[model samples]
Target: MVWVRLPVYFYKRNDTFYFSRSIPSDLQHRFNKRKIEVSLRTKSEAKAAKSAAALSDRLERYWDSLRMEMIYSRELGLKVLQDTKPCTTSEYSLSDALALYHRLKGGSKTKLFYDVSNRSIRYLEECLGHDNLTSIEKSDAGRFRDYLFARGMSSSSVKRVFSSVRAIINLAIREQGLVITNVFSGTFIPDDGAKQQRTPIPQDALKRVQMVCQTLDDEPRWLIALISDTGMRLSEACGLLTSDIHVDTVKPYIELIEHPWRRLKTASSSRQLPLVGASLWAAEKIIKEGNSFAFPKYCSEAKCNSNSASAALNKWLKPRVPAGCVIHSFRHSLRDRLRAIECPADIIDAIGGWTTEGVGHKYGDGHTLSVKYRWMEKIAPKVRELRSEETVT
Candidate 1:
C-alpha cells in the first residue's frame, strides 16, 4: 500500500482558510462524506493556522462523540443507520459495557485493576464525548492515544490504558456480538523493555533506614525492615498475617500467598521466601506483638493498603535514601544483591517470584522451598550496627 504524509489539519480554497482531514473509510459512512472540511475563511497564515487548529479539534471531537453513540446504540440492539449500513438495536452505553466487563472479569484481581479499566473508559468518554460502541473509530483510538500522552502519562502508562480499551471492545464484541472493529488493536505503543526507573537504595543509605526502624519501634518501620531483607513487594510485606509468618521452621520465611486483602502478582509470587537478617528479626518481634497482621496500619483481612503504605513510607524514606530511590527500591536492591553474588537465574526468579523463561521451567516440580531458602540465606544482613546510620549525614 502506498502512504502519503498529511499535514496538520490545514487547508485553503481561493485564499479562504480551512481545516480538513480524510475521515477513515469505515467511519465515512457516519458523515456521508470522506473529508472533514471546516472553513475558517481567513487569509492571514498565522490567524488561519490558529483558526484551523481550533476548528480541526472541534470537528474531531464531534466525529468521535458521534461514533461512540452509534456503537453504543448498536450494542443495545438498536438499528442505527450509518449511511446505508444497518446496525442492530441495543441499549448498551460505553459506560454500561465497561461496567459489565468489570463484573465479568472478576476474581482474584485487585481493586487497582478495575480502577485502571474504569479510568481508561472515563478518559475515552472525556475525549470522545460519551458515545456507544459503534462510535469508536480507528481515528478515535488514535486520538485517545495522543490524548493520553497529552495528559503527561508515561509511555508504559499509555500502553496499559489502551490495553484496557482493547479488552473492553473485545468483550463487547464477543458477549454482545457487536460488529464494531477494535480500533485499539493496531495503534503505536511505545517500547518499554529498558530497566526500571526506580534506583536501588545504596548500602550506606540502608543503614540509615535500619537505624530509623530500630528507633521508631513501629509496625510500619518494622514492615520496611522486613521487606529490605526479604526483597518482597511492598504489598506482599504489608499484607502479611501472623498465620503467613512461619518462624518455627529451621529455615524461617514468610508465606506469600493470594489473599483477598492482598492478591499475589503471579503464581511464582506465591512461594515461601526465607526470612533472614532484619526480616527474621522483625518477624520474630511481630509474632511477639500478637497482632493479626505484621503491619496493622497498612493491612486488614478485607483489603491491603500497599499503595498508601508506600506513599507514607516513601515520604519518610525519600530524604533518608539517595535521589531516585523510593521505599520500593529495597526490592530492586535485593535483585541486584542476588545478581552480584552470582545466584542462578532460576533461583533468583524463584526467590523474587519472577516468571521463569521457557516452557521447560514449567515441566519440573521446580526448586523446593528449602532450595530457595538456601540461596536466600546467602545474602548477609543490611545493617552491621546502628551506629553506621548515625555516622552518615
Candidate 2:
C-alpha cells in the first residue's frame, strides 16, 4: 500500500525528531507557551512521521474544540458559555471527599485528624460556598488562601489548610478515575516570616525543672518527668497504657505503641524507649499508681487530650524555661545532650523515634533496649544527680 503523505510537523535536532505546532493567536491566552512541542523519540523518519501525524490530529481536534468554545462565547455571553461547559460537575463534592478520606484513612487516627479535616473543609466552604471538587477553580483557591491569610493565619498554617483541601480533592480524583485538575494542588502560599524555632531548654533550667517536678511528685509532675528524659512526644507519653511501662523488666523501658485514643506520628515512632533518670522514676511511679492508662487525667479509652496536657504543662513550665521553650523543648534538649556525649546519629534517631533516611534503616526492629540503655545511661546521670543534690539541699 502506498503511504499517502500528510502534513507531518517533524523537526530533527541532535538526531531526534519532535512534533511542534504554534498556538492560534486567539487561543494563546489559554496556554502558557506559544508553541506546543512533544518529542517523537525516534531517529527514523517513518516512525517520526507516524508519531507526528497522530500528535497533529489530536492537537487539531483539541484546538477545534477551543475554537468552538470561543465562537459560543462571542454569540452567547461568557457567563452563558461557562454555564454550559461540559465536565464542570464532579461526582464527589468537597464534603464528600472529606467523608471518603475519613472513611478510608481514619483507622487508628485520633480525633485531631477528623477535626483538622473538618476545619480545613469548613474554611474552604466558608470562603467558596462548598463548590463541587471539580468546580473548584484556581481563582477560588487563590481567594480561599487570601481569606485564610486575612484572618491572621500564618503562612505555614495556610499551607496546612491547602494541604488538606488538596489531599481530599486528589483522593476523589484518583479513587473515581476522574480526569480533573486539583486547583488547590499548586497554589502559591507566601511566607509570612521566619518561624520561631522552639528553643531547647537550658541544661541548668532542665535540672531545676526536674528538681521541681520531683519535689511536687504529683500526676502532672510524673507526665513532665516521663518526657524529660525519654524524648517521647507529649501525646505519646500522655496516651501510654500503664502496662506500656516495663520497670519490672531487667532493663527498664517503655513500649511506645499506638493506642486507640492516640496514634504514633510515624512508623518509626513505634519503638521501645529505655527509661532512665526522671523518665524511669516517673515510670515506677506510674506502675505503682496502677491505673489502666498512664496519664488518666489526659488520656481516656475514647481520646488522648494531649492539647489540654500541653496547655497546663506549658503554663507551669513557662516561668521555669527560657523564652520560646515549651514542653517539646525536652525532646530537643535530649537530642542536644545525646550529641554532646558524641552519641552516633543513628542511635540518637532511634532513641528519639525520629525518621532516618535509607531503606536499610527500616529493615529490622531498631536498637534493642539493652543497646539503647547504654546510650541513654550516658546522658541521664546528670539529671539523676541533680535530683539527689536538690533533695539534700
Candidate 3:
C-alpha cells in the first residue's frame, strides 16, 4: 500500500509552481481571458498547494459575488444583456467609481489628488454625460481625449486626466466584481513638444532673481532663495519643519523627510540637501525666525498649501524672472549649474533628489553630505560677483 498527496490545480514550469484554473461559463465574460493563471512563486510543493488552494477559494468567492449581483439585478427588474453587447447600466456609475476611488486611495494623499480626480470626472461628464461604468466605450474614451485637446489641454495634462479616470474605474471594477472593459486604458496621447518644456532660467536672470530675493527678504523670498539653489519641489520646501533645517550643524544641510501634511514626491526626493550660497542664507534666516514650520504661511499641521504658494510666487516672479521660467525653473537651473561645474551625474542626481537609473545606483548609502557639499560649494558664489564678471566679459 502507498500514500499519495492530494493533487492541486498547479503545475511546475521553469522550476517554479504556477496555479491555473478555468473560469466558469457564467463568469467568463467578467475577465478578458478564458483561463486564470498565477505564479505561486515557490519551489516547494506544499507552499504551491497552499497558495493554489487559497487563490481558488478567493476566485470562487468572487465568482459567487458576481452571480449574486446578477441574481439581485434580475430581482430589481434590470434586464440581463447578451455577451455580444455592452451592459446598458451597472450597479456602479462613474460617480460611484469616483467615490470608491476617493475612499480607498485618498488617504494620506495631497489636495492635488482629489482636485485632479474630480476635475477628470467633471470633464468626462461634460464630454460624454454621466454614464454607468460598463457603458463607457473605447470610442467614448477617444472622444474624451479629443475633447481635452480641443479645450487647449496639453497632451501630458490630458494623459494625467485619463490616468485618474482609469484608476477610478479600475478600482470599481475590482471591488464590485463588475464585468466591464476600462475604455480609458489604451487611448493614444500625442506629444506636447516644446510646450511642455520648462526652460531653465538664464544664469544672468538667475543671479538677478537671487539678488532681488535677498533684497525682499520676506517669507516668500526666503522660500524662493532656498529653492533656487537647493532644487527642492515647491511642496517639499513648503512642508519643511524648522527642525529640518540644520544651519548650526557641522554640515549645515536640510534633512528632507516626509511629513503627514507633505509627502516626498519620490523615494529619491527624500535626501539631505547641502545648504550653499542663497540656500544657506535662507536656511539661516528660517531657523533664526524660530517658527514651528519652516514656511508657516504655506505649511501647517494639516497641509502644505503648494498651490497657493505657486500662484503668489509665480505672479511675483513673472516680472523678476524671464518668461517661461517659473519657480520650478530653479530646479532646472540648479542641474545646469551643477553640470557647468562638471559635477558627476550620479552626484548631481543625488543632490537634486532626482531618481538615478541602474540597479547599481541603489546599492550603497549614496554620496555623503560632505561629498555633495564639496560639489555644491563650486557653484556657491556672490550674485554681484557673477554679474560683474558677465559685464567684464
Candidate 4:
C-alpha cells in the first residue's frame, strides 16, 4: 500500500523536528507572537509527523477561537457579518456572574464552602479583574492553573479550585441564560493523583496522641478524644447541640442533625455515630457540663462554627501528630480501621456518613443504631488494642 502524502509543517534543527505554524494575518496582533512552534523532540519523520499533527490541530482551534472573539467583541477592521452578534450588554462581567452564581446556588452551604468558591473567583479577579464572562478563553483557564501551582498549591487543590471556578461559570450559563462556553469545563491539572491530601494517621502516632489527649483538660482535647473513636468530622463535632447526644438510649450514639446554628455537609452526613471507648468518655464529660451547645466556644451563632473549630484543632494537632497528619485524618483512620476489621462495607459507610452503594433503599429501615453500635465498637481504634498491635508489628 502506498502512503498518500498530505501537507505537513515541520522544521528540523539540531537533528530534531519542530512543529511550526504561522499565525493568521488577521489574528496575529491578538497573540504576543507572530507564529507558534512546538518541539516534536524526535528525529524520525514518522514520529515527528504524528506529534506535529496534534500540535497543529490545537493551534488551529485556538486561532479559530481568537478569530471568533474578534468578530464578536471588536467593531473595527472586520467584516460586519450577519451571524456575528457583537458583544455588548450580552456579555456579563465575571464579578457580577460570581455574585449571581453564589446567591442562587450557595445559600445553604457552610461559610468555608462559600469561602472556597469566593476565593477561587477572587483569584481570577486578581489575574483578570472585571473581565467579561463571554470573553474568557481557554488560555485564561490554563493561566489560572499555573497561578495556583506558582502559589504552591497541590494538584488536587488546584483541581478543586478550578472545579469551583467551572461551577460558577457553568451555573451562569445554564441558569441565567449566559452565552459563553465554560472555558474551564474540561481544563486538566497534571498529576492530581500523585499525592493525596488526607491520609490515615499511623497507628503509633495515633496511640501517642490518644495518650497525651487523656491528660489535657481543655475543650480542644475533649473534642480530639471524642472523635478519636467515633471518627466524627471536625465540623459535625463542633456544631453539636446538647439535644444531639443520646447517651441514655440502649445503644448510646451521637445524633448529628442540622440545627438553626449549623447546617450539615450533606443529608447523608447527618448520622448516628455510636459512642465507644474515648468517645463515650468524652460524651459523658460533655453531658456533665449541661450547656445548650456541646462546645460553646466554637458553636456561637456569630462565628463560622466549622472554621473556628478547624483552626483551633489544626493548630493544636500540628505539633502533636506526625507529619502530613491533620485533624481530618481521624476520619481516614477510622475508615481504614473499619476496613481492616472486615466490617461490612455498607455499615462502615453508614457509620461514617458516607453514601451506601445499593443498601437499605428498598425494604429495611436502614441499619439500626444497635447494629451500628456493635460494628463501631468492634473497630473503635482504641489505644490499648491498636497500640499493642502496633508494638507487635
Candidate 5:
C-alpha cells in the first residue's frame, strides 16, 4: 500500500468518514473558500486512517515551514514539481518557445530578432539538426563550437551565435518550463577576438558626405546629415518622425523618445540629440515642409533594405565624400570631433546616446540629448573649421 502526504479534508457522504486529501493551501486560496466534497478510495478503514494521518502531518509541516520562514524552499520545491509534471497539453518544444517570442514581440522588434536569430539558428541546425531539446547535452554545444571553427567563422562570430543560442534555450526554460539546463552557461568559447573597431570618418570625409547629400535628389540625404551630426543609429534615424523634431528656437533638437512599436537597443539609445551647423539646417528644412517622417520615402521599400540609403549615397556622392566612408561613418566622425575638443566622456556619451559611465557602463543605460548638446556646442565649431580647411586643401 502506497501513501502520499497531502492536506486532509472530510466530506459527509452516506454518513460515513469519507476522508480525502485537501488541495494545498496556496492552490486552494486561488479559489473561494467554500465546503467541497472529496473522496478517498481505500480498501480498508485502517488504510484510510493512515492516509488521513499522513495528510494531517503534511499540512502541519507546511504550516511549520511557513512560520519558520522556509517558504522560499517550499516554493522552489513546488516549482520543481510543477516543471517535472506531465503537461496537460503536449510538452513544450524549442520551436514553441521561438514562436512564443515572435508572437510577444512587435513587428519591428520581431524583424530585428529575425535578422539576428536567422544566422544563429542556421548554425545551430547545422550542428544539432536532428536533436530535440531533451537530447541536447554540453558535449553537443562544444561540438557546435568546433563546427563553427571548422567552417572558418571568426571567434567573435562564433561567440555571437553561441550567445544567441543560449538566449533561445533560456527563453525556453523560463517561459516553457522545459526540463533542461542551459548547456552554454559557464562554457567558454575560444575567442580570436578582434579589437572593437569604430569606423568614424575624418572631418574631410564628413564634408564630402554632406556635400554629396546636398547634391543628391533623395530626401534621405538629409538623414545622412542628421546621423553625421547627431550620431544616431541608422535604424533610429530611419524610424524618426517629424513630430520628434523640435526646431522653433535657436537651440533646436530631436527627441529620440520611444519609437511606436520598437524599444531602443539600449536605454542610453533613447535620448534627444541637439541639431547644429549644416545638420540642423538640413533637418529644419525637412521639418518645415510638414513631412511626418524625416526619411518617409525609402528609395526601395520592396525589400526593406537599409543599404539602399548607403547605395544612393555611394552612387551620387562618392566623389564628394572620402574613400571608405559609409553612412555610419558620420557618427564616427562626430565622435572623433568630440574627442579632439576634449569633451567630457559622460557628456559625449549622453549626446551620442551611449551610456559609457557609471550605471550605463555597467548595464548600458543611454543618456539624453541635453547632456550631449553641451558637448556638441563645443565640438561643432571644430567640425565646421575642419570642413572649411578641407575646402581650402
Candidate 6:
C-alpha cells in the first residue's frame, strides 16, 4: 500500500490533538511529524480530504468538551474513555466472542459453554444490539441485571450470566488487546443466599437405578456402571479409549491421560480410577471389541448426542433413582460413599478426580491401582450395604 501524509497543522492542548483543514484526525498524529505532497486525482479528491479534516476538527472539539468535564470528575474522564475507545480489529461483538470461544473449545466444552451462554447472549442482544463494546456502560449492565431479575432469574443465574460477559470481555482484552474495561465490576448481582445444594443419590436410589439399567436394551449399561463405580465425569468417561485401560496388568487400572487436542475440564479431572468388578468387566468387554474405544461407537463420536443415553436413563433408570437425581448424581453418590467409608480427603480427592483444597495445588497426580482400587472396593461394599440397609428398613 502506497502511504502519503497530507500537509496539516496540529495544535496539542491538554493531551488532545486538533487538526487543520486537510488531514484526518486518525492521520493528525502522523501528519504533525512531517508534510508530504498528495497526488490529488481530481477536485473531488481534494474536497473529500477537506471534508474529512472538518469532521476531525469537530470531533476534536467534542473531545475537548468531554475533557473539560473530566477536569472536575475522574469518573467522567473514565466514562468518556470507556465510551469513545475504538474497538480493535480483533475485538468482536458479544455474539462473535461467544462463537470464537466455542470454536476454541471444540469438544464437549464447546457444547456446555454454548448451552449456558446462548441464553445470556440472546438477552444481551435484546438489550444492546446497537451498542458496541465501547458503548456498553455500567448503567447498561445494571439495566440487563434488572431485566434478568424481572424474568425471575435467580441471583446465581444472574451471576452466571455476568460471569459469562466478564469472560468474553477479558478474552477480548487478552487476545485482541482491546481498550475496554470489565464493566461488570461492582455491579449489584442478586444473592438469594440459600445454602449450596450437593445432593448425591442415596444408596437405595443408585441400586434401583442400576436394576433398571439391567432391564434396558441400551449398550451403555457399562457406561453408567463406570460412572457410578469410578466417579469419572461423563466427558472423561466418554473420552476414554481402549489404550487408556490396563486390564491385563497385575493390578488393573484406567489411565487418565491427556490428549493434545482435548482437555479435562480441570487438571484434577485427569487422574486414574481403578478398574474392578463391574467397572473392570465393562472395560474388558469394550476392549475386546477390537475397536480402540472403551465405549460404543456413538458414545465416542465427536458430535455424539447424550440425548439418547439420557433419555434411556431417564425413562428406565430415573424412576428407580430418587426424584431430581441426574446422571451426575453418580459422582456425588460415589463421593458420599467414600465419606461413609472414612476414606482420607486426599484419597477421596484422587479417586473422584477432585481438585485439592486451597490455591496452589489444583489436581492430584495419578494414584496407584491398589490405592484407587481400595477406595473402589470400599465404595462398592458401601453401596451394597446401603441397599441392604434400605431393604431392611
Choose the strongest candidate by TM-score: 2
Relative to the true structure, how large is the alpha-carbon lDDT of every model? 0.77, 0.82, 0.83, 0.75, 0.63, 0.62
Instruction: Give residue 27's lDDT in candidate 4 (0 to 100).
Output: 62
lDDT of 2: 0.82
Could you tell which candidate, 1 or 5, scores higher by TM-score? 1
- Model 4: how large is the Cα RMSD against the reference? 12.2
TM-scores for the candidates: 0.74, 0.75, 0.73, 0.70, 0.65, 0.66
lDDT of 4 by residue, 153-181 (tens): 88988888998888888877777676568
Task: In candidate 6, list every pair of residues with a backbone clash.
Answer: none
Per-residue lDDT of 1-393 in model 2, one digit per residue for the tens? Answer: 999966558799999877787877876666556876655656888877775665566567767877897789878877433333243232346766788899988876767789999999878765653334554556787899899998889999999998988888788888867777888878888898857889999887887888888888999999999999998899999999999889887889998998767888998899899999888888989999999999999989888899999999999999888999999999999999999999999999999999999989888777888889999998885555766675511
| 318-372 per-residue lDDT for model 5 (tens digits) | 5555566666667777778988988877777777777575543655444445556
Candidate 6, TM-score vs. the true structure?
A: 0.66
Please give the ranking of all candidate structures by TM-score, highest first, separated by commas.
Answer: 2, 1, 3, 4, 6, 5
Off by over 4 Å in 4: 1-91, 192-194, 203-207, 359-363, 381-393
Return the top candidate by lDDT: 3
In Å, residue 33's CA in model 6 sits off its true spot by 26
Ranking by lDDT: 3, 2, 1, 4, 5, 6
The number of clashing residue pairs in each candidate reads 20, 0, 0, 0, 6, 0
Q: Write one digit per residue (lDDT tens) for candidate 3, span 311-340.
A: 999999888777798999999999999999
Better of 4 and 5 by TM-score: 4
